[model samples]
Target: MSDIQIRPVTENDHAAWLPLWQAYLTFYKTELSDAVIASTWARFLDRSEPTNAALAWQDGKAVGMVHFIYHRSNWSIANACYLQDLLVAPEQRGTGVGRLLIEHVYKTAKANGCDKVHWLTHETNATAIQLYERIAERPGYIQFRKMI
Candidate 1:
């Protein structure tokens, strides 16, 4: 239990958000173009975009971040919220920052008329899976994707 404050990302958050974003990319062993990063930051600040972000702060420093998207769902009348990205600063891991960020997304989705909030993690991420299992139930669905 840590004193973490979670809030929606603002235009001013770009500077603080970049390192976290890069660290997250590095963790996945993936790289993106500068153009892509710029576009993503823009989307986070654009109210018209389905993509959005939030940050978790502790002692005036950002400790974690989450990015999510809202989209129509075939099974539900309300839109579904897909939590696309989440990261906790290495020094702040295990400090409840990740859970707080997730809870923020859950509240945000509910406030925005989402019927559900869901996310996916790599099968090998055991540490994250442990916390996720405690807070959420796996619907037992396997994900398959084709990158074009």
Candidate 2:
């Protein structure tokens, strides 16, 4: 925790950032096309886009990354922040990197005047669930979706 540094993803960080992003998608058993990946990276670097990304570095090595988005919400007057993606290197798990990244989002959301910050995890992600339980309440809202 003491050596970990979490910072915004800069334009020059593409190489350092790609592996972490690919690992995250792999963890979820999802495969995205190169075009989608390119677009997402572009959005992260675009200042006018509501999407943002941050990387966690330790000993000058990038070990984790988190991506979030800000959008208007009908339930709240202020914008809502969604923590869309978060991943820490397998070796870095249990070392507090994930928590630090989440805390970064919390602070960023507040600074941006967002009313809430939320995220979803697969039910089988017990490790993350434990951490989330300690930091947030379970709102008990089940999610349902259909792809067109």
What are the runs in model 1 whose C-alpha is more than 4 Å off? Answer: none
RMSD of 1: 0.9
Best by TM-score: 2
Root-mean-square deviation of every model: 0.9, 0.8
RMSD in Å for model 2: 0.8
- How displaced is residue 39 in candidate 2, in Å? 0.3
lDDT of 1 by residue, 27-48 (tens): 9999999999999999988899
- Compared with the true structure, model 2 gives a TM-score of 0.98
**Which residue pairs clash within candidate 2?**
none
On residues 1-148, what C-alpha lDDT tens digit does candidate 2 reach at each position? Answer: 6599999999999999999999999999999999999999999999999999999999889999999999999998999999999998999999899999999999999999997999999999999999999988899999999999
Over 4 Å off, model 2: none
